[model samples]
Target: MERDKGKLELIATQRVNANSEMYKVVDFLNKSLKNYHLMFGLTKKDESMVISIYEVE
Candidate 1:
């Protein structure tokens, strides 16, 4: 039905937006890592606290 088609289109558009946001986040992280000579690793204290070290160049 036309209603189903509309729902599918909305879902597709949402997926596209999510993918675009993911790409932007990845790009930003990559640029920051490169610009700062940064190193990142998982911390033992907690799973969420990722440790990132950067040295001034």
Candidate 2:
């Protein structure tokens, strides 16, 4: 941990276009990864969906 917090390291990222159902996938991944000290994040960039995976420890 850095500064008393677990450092988040980016493991993967992808940008998908024309997919409206991607939130469901991110939700599922978040649920599944919670117990493993991992996180799934999503962002809206222009017309694309940006997804990322981070390790919490």
Candidate 3:
């Protein structure tokens, strides 16, 4: 039972780490997308970034 708990903890930690990395990727992508939109004059709001263009439309 202790071993199983340890494994579960490890899995949860890994998932949190993965989620952190994913969030970082999302931030980077959002910054890039915002830049692209600014270059194209597609968005005027400074808050818009990283989200899908279709969603904005």
Q: Which candidate number would show the highest TM-score if scored against the true structure?
A: 2
Candidate 2 weakest lDDT stretch, 10 residues: 1-10
lDDT of 3: 0.32
Q: Write the per-residue lDDT of candidate 1 for residues 1-57, one digit (tens) a residue.
A: 234321211111111222324445545665767555443322333223333333333
lDDT of 1 at 3: 40
**What local lDDT score does residue 41 receive in model 3, on the 0 to 100 scale?**
16
lDDT of 1: 0.36
Stretches of candidate 3 exceeding 4 Å from the true structure: 1-18, 36-55
- Full ranking by TM-score: 2, 3, 1
On lDDT, the candidate that comes out on top is 2
CA deviation > 4 Å runs, candidate 2 = 1-3
Can you give the TM-score per candidate against the true fold? 0.28, 0.75, 0.31
